[model samples]
Target: MTIAPAASTSALSFDPADPVALTQALVRCPSVTPEEGGALALLATALAAEGYEVHRPVFSEPDTPNVENLYARIGSEGPVLIIAGHTDVVPVGDAAAWTREPFAGTIENGILYGRGACDMKGGLAAMAAAAIRYRRANPDAPGSIAFLVTGDEEGPAVNGTVKLLEWAHRRGERFDHCILGEPTNPATMSDMIKIGRRGSLTGRLTVQGTQGHVGYPHLADNPIRGMVRLLAALDATPLDTGTAHFDPSNLEVTTLDVGNPATNVIPAQAKAVFNIRFNDVWTPETLAAEIERRLREAAGNTVRYEIGFQPTNAVAFLTEPGPFVAMVADAVAAETGKRPALSTTGGTSDARFIKSYCPVVEYGVVGKTMHQIDESVAVADVLALERITHRLLASYFAAQHNA
Candidate 1:
């Protein structure tokens, strides 16, 4: 359930230096997807010391083990503002390729480096620092300010934001607006603001055939041949022309495999994996049906196949040019002297779920090094992001007060 304000939410302010330290502090924790790694506890303790009410809930499901999450709020009133992001980082694929130890949270030449440094930990620290600064500046500010953070955002995502929102809703917590600190800036922090995202769907097709000697072509059906035909059919056409708010839909064949090594034998099965990032022009149902149709036509009773699609259901969604969008644009323009493009391109994020509850927009540090080996955020950029976030909250809250 959502956490409420404590007996007495204390007025707290942190050193601007604390945010950089917090970024390193969080990167030091190995909270790789669904693992707490003391990240949540550290945040909870820090927030609690600032006199905010903190709740760390463990959410679970049938097969997935429980994951720890943190929800903290500094007020129990209206005009509620929420800053949300995930703490978990993806696995450090090849640790040996790193310039420094992945989780060491090392800082050199004014650059802080680590796994979570940019993916979100750095952005998270910036938000927390901004919040602390806002609280200190406006101790009696109207409306409550809260943070909804989860551990499962970087993993399967089944028990993450989707579940956390449900938990918070059950407690009757309504958020006026939310800022998801995803690494939205593309190049120089002037590139983009992800106002929405296209839908993503992944499917794996397994074509079945009778195994036989390579010379016995007439005696047995070859699934590899069928698989190739099916892939060709799907890859033959572009999904659609680019939409006004989204880019053109595209389908890519990620993998194709046949488990066979012999030169004279035909494999019993051939499988291929493909994914689609569709625009609003098509729904999952329509796109999925189209794929099935293409596969059936290509196979034409030559080989039997089983198709399994894993639906991420990140349907294309956009927040119209409203107050939230305008304010963020204004913040970027004011801070960086560049008005970012309101984009709906790129991969899915927790904002997809947050959009269901409130108007959400993603704004944060430059993402150039997010998932890289030596993921790092520039020291100046971190401070600049802190300022942008601070200004966003100030402007948003001010707008609410004036309204």
Candidate 2:
């Protein structure tokens, strides 16, 4: 099928060995959340050139924005290895403050600068390049290789990977393992490999009260006071000591809102939002019950409050250390000369969604500049990441064939 040129920038020649050009080309597309911006089309065109059967499906919900997602596969059979990432980037805040055009995809002093460069259009480019190169060299490679690219990761994530996976499953797509190309490295390309992610839960607590003159203590019930006390109760004790594979659970109050400007009047209601990054020791149901128990005990009969939990699919997960992990780690060490630490300390990603299907891990470029004004990635690191991915594919397919 013929694909149209990307709307943001003209299509450039794509080379499998050199991912820098592809990275630059992709960054030129201004694909902010829920927008196509020709990013997926560009990728689909490039993958089609490499013999992948590409499918672009636009998913929708009642209130959420419709999202476009891509699923492309190159081979017909064997162990399927899926490389997942997103092309849609977060909104560029205050464009005037940027050192260069946020969508220009400029390379200055050997660094590629643009949104999604590190967080992770660069990674996506590298994965594509690596897959192409591997397919060319090992035309009869034992397993199939696929790309699951989404445009809804940075938004509410309702119509993205979670739904795409289900769609693929209904069509009888079974993956042996998956790799998420999120920006996992905190410092350098070789810093770490994410084996797991902490679970996320957000709660909105609203305390009810009677509005009255501030001077009349007996007539007014101040919900703000009760809100503060209840929050303190939730924060008073540690959720748990650090587990062997995870850190201590943390609850942070993100916002407190009473919205009352007049000092003479007590507000009728106070609301506070808190988010918890919990470990595997607790499930969402248990955690919610525990939190409610604490709030009820702290509130007593005097404080009237209501707690509600936001819907979330982010559950804590771990991919045990096995041949797959060791193989990827070895590939990194071989390419960068640094043994990466297997860590589970980061915010959640789409890996949380893929864990249900198969073993999944995350490793990509350095993320220090992701979502920043002058977001970028070192050109050299992009090439290195491509090489690492290439090596991983080679080893993975070889092991499967031998086994």
Candidate 3:
């Protein structure tokens, strides 16, 4: 990372380490997926002005839109702790239904409302504020703290963290451990800590049948019958009872469609798409093979069917309870006065990609209205998250001093 000149304070209205103010500024930006909307540049400028070396790398793919990501650090030393998050937010459906302006970053009474307030612009801002405070206090901390912010998480996930991590690695940036600032809490800032996430696999099951008049008895083979039978087979048994750290792998049918408009005519084709959130019990290959086995047994060489799975990057992973995890847990417990559950029960996140590089866990604010009409976060929760993050950082670098 090159040392860029400090930006003027004119762009930043609030204190550099104020999480609540920073989150409001971030939420005001309409950074819908794949759009910069000035979120990264705003944060980069703020971080650079605080004496951190910042680098913004824009990535591109054949079909996906270009994306910009930021990597910044204030210290150069051992045992780097990377804080990762995305600035892009999902599109707000029915924007008119929002109580406040979707991009205004409105603060009503005590709650801040905006599109990305909870599902995780707030988390990113909390960590940023905490890191800034830590650097100001310990200018030459023994261990380094780095921020990895991306703009393509809510998009196709291409040209984002996956590529950013690779680019950083190629440039000689190594991470010792990572704390992803995803919204892990269910109702409060200290509700939960996501230690791991399940894998995701989606497949489409299609059955071919001859189109004919519905009045005809034996003229056509109804694919709907075969589709129902195949679906039944897939759901007949559980993939696994439950893993020690993970819940039972679940498969749910998302869509059953024939695209047929006329009720009097039998559709020529029937298809059902389903998704599986699996545990460590199986890999994508194994899961697909198992589905095939079940479908084959039910088909008996009579049903004409084909099953195809979509490409996936999410895979089950866990960071076993250890010194590093304990450090984070201790920080949250001490700050919140509640012992947070070390859970792996939610949908997958970018941690699936980061886990390959280093041990990674996710902890952040409550996300009740994530991607909803009035997405919001409590002002006090953001402040608490900042404090917890600062405590964790202090503990992490103190260990290095002891070493």
Winner by TM-score: 3
User: Where does the lowest 10-residue lDDT sum fall in candidate 3?
Assistant: 1-10
Candidates in order have lDDT scores of: 0.84, 0.90, 0.90
Q: Which stretches of candidate 2 lie over 4 Å from their true place?
A: 1-12
Q: Please, what are the lDDT tens digits per residue for candidate 2 over residues 1-403? A: 1122322323446564569988998899999998988889888888877778888877888899988888999898879999999999999999999999999999989999999898889999998889988998988888899899899999999888998898889889999999888888988889999999999999999999999998997998999899989999999999889677899989999999999999999999999999999989888888899999999999999899999999989899899999999999999999999999998897889998999999998999999998999999999989999999999999999988998
Rank order (by lDDT, best first) = 3, 2, 1
What tens digits encode model 3's per-residue C-alpha lDDT throughout 149-239? 8899998998889998998999899899999999999987668888899999999999999999999948998999999999999999998
Error of 1 at 181 (Å): 0.6
Model 1 scores a C-alpha lDDT of 0.84
- Give the TM-score of each candidate: 0.93, 0.96, 0.97
Cα RMSDs, all models:
2.8, 2.6, 2.0
- Order of all candidates by TM-score, from best down to worst? 3, 2, 1
Model 1 pairs whose backbones collide: none
Instruction: Kindly report which residue stretches of model 1 are placed more than 4 angstroms away from their true locations once superposed.
Output: 1-17
Model 3: clashing residue pairs?
A: none
Question: What is the per-residue lDDT of model 1 for residues 1-403, given as tens digits with 9 covering 90 to 100?
Answer: 3332232233223343368878888899999987888788777767877667787777778788578887889987888888999999999989999989999888899888999899899999998988988888888888888999999888888878888888888889898788889998888777788888888989999999888988987787788888888888888878789877888999988888997999899888999998899888888888899899888888786768999888564877887778789998898888898999998877999988998998888988889898888999887777878888889879988887898
Model 3, residue 146: what's the lDDT? Answer: 85
